[model samples]
Target: MKKNIYYFDNSATTWPKPECVLNNLKYFLNEIGGSPGRSGHRMSIAASRLIEETRETVGKFFNYDDTSRIIFTKNITESLNICIFSLLKAGDHVITTNSEHNSVMRPLRFLEKKGLKITIVKCNRFGELDIHDIKNSIVKNTKMVILTHASNVIGTILPIEEIANLTFKKNIPFVIDCAQTAGSVPIGINLGKYKNCIIAFTGHKAMLGPTGTGGLCIGKDVSLKPLVFGGTGSKSDEDTQPNFLPDSLESGTMNVLGLAALKASVNYLLKMGVDKIREHEKNLITRFIEEASKIKRIELYGTKEAEKQASLISFNLKNLSPSAAGLILDKKYSIMCRIGLHCNPNAHKVIGTFPNGTIRFSFSYFNNLKQIDYAIEKIKEISRIE
Candidate 1:
């Protein structure tokens, strides 16, 4: 008998998107196909309407009143790059956390070479940050404070709401890297009130959208220079780019097909409810951790408190390299997971897994208790081997 395959690597990208997303993707390609805002034709108008509707849906989902402030990009990485490059200039000091993914680290590193000052606040071994460290690091010249809503490796949820309030009080811009938490965790942002906060999100993960779909919700007080330049379908009569919310940052052709799928996925998530999905995944993680704790030689990371973390867990078996165990899980047990640094070397360092990272099992709403039990049993078996 062939063994069934179990997927546990949701932090990389969500698997098995909702049927509505797939159906709409097909429908857009088949029926409504046109470049949005380019022409007055019926097909073009329909496509444009779909894009606007998606923008509004995303805005509503994030509690942002102005849908025009939402700007789409290929992924969260691009969104972060646009924000980083556009907001910070030479000699500007920026604050970030040590647990940030390379999407934020790499850009900040590049900017450091360009005469930008960066302060990387340290997080504890459990991936929890001290709010005081962030506060003390803020100097008069601090241009912005960028942080991840949750650590991708260990899955520790940060106190973004408090940090946002801190930045707002300090009169600094707060940018949140919500690549891992968006659609999975509630981002308490009242866009109408908080004009200094920005939320960057990717659609392929918890949003259950296509890979190429992601965007950023710009606050009212924030403005970013265009990372790319081209035709925005509007203001074609003039040579300069349009001075507007989305069009200023968004140029060239939009990802109509991907956005269509994203719109459908967002609608499904709205109907299903994010809190319900979060609770289900939390149960899976809690169950996994409780069972895995009983196994000898299993060293887990993070706060170990399910409510304090997201749906992911990272740990190692005794005398087992994560890479080797990952291979065993894939080839022998047919369990898929992520191992190694997960693109956040700083997070690994904080957890004392610098060179060799830990095995990561990230759960999703679709995962069941049976799958978690099986994975825990297999991990116990693996730990007993040596």
Candidate 2:
């Protein structure tokens, strides 16, 4: 194994987080160790303030004003599960794309077995979704439109704005999985208008926060039942769940330490500006794609254009299984990346890489052209391995 590691797996979780995140985590652990919304002590009040401030920062980050609707979860998977299991009933119909992660698919499939109808609109091999496809798929009974803002497998960005507009006109709930784009790309929904939209985001990825931190920015028009019922500290006198925005969804002791770090991370993003980070990652993707295209055995996937996708690229080296190549990349070159179907077999099938998936390089703002060049060089060397 090589000593120096070049991380290209931001889509999974971002490593080398900003210094502020770590600093805040330490600060919370050392000083403010109390459960938010659970007590009246000063420590508890401080913890609650951290969470509310983090909620406010997230609201400004997403350009949404309603901070009370921001509900935190352990990860985007939980946020998505809350949306899927709470909003849709047995007879309800939901629309999603074939490019969704298991977070969306698994819950929907679970409901499908119980009589819920699901429509998976197929995207092009490049993972590009046509907004018209979603429009055409909408039915009279369609209760929700749930899909990813970007494909976790291919890094292809979907037309969420158009889809949100369409769903808004139809008066249907629109759920967006922002796991891959939350910190890297600007979330394009104007909540004032598209009040039916729900954006699920994770903190560990591009947000540069620690794991066990993620949340859902709920729209005004959308109301979901509590997925986990417990003590929200509010309406604790009643045993039943609270019929409110965040309290309705958030039930338990909030992750105050994680939220403390998340607040710092989001503050960092707001300070650095997401557009600048996006531009840097786009440059990495553009350079990687350009170099990888020149390699003899490399078969690039997705749109092969930086502008068309997120900050990641998927490709396969001819005569090399993704698993084998990934192992070699890890052991020989210290290049960390994700391979195989990336937990989304539907996306792999769409791109004709099912069973044998492509090696995915998910870049981050911290990654640069030098790392991209090195990875491409390593891939070139790996391609020659007979």
Worst 10 residues of 2 by lDDT: 1-10
TM-score for all models, in order of appearance: 0.98, 0.98
Candidate 1 local lDDT, 40-104, one digit each (tens) = 99999999999999998898789886888899999999999998999998899999999999999
* Root-mean-square deviation per candidate: 1.5, 1.4
Judge candidate 1 at residue 31 and give its lDDT.
Answer: 95
Question: Distance (Å) between predicted and true CA of 49, model 1?
Answer: 0.4
Candidate 1's TM-score reads 0.98
- In model 2, the clashing pairs are none
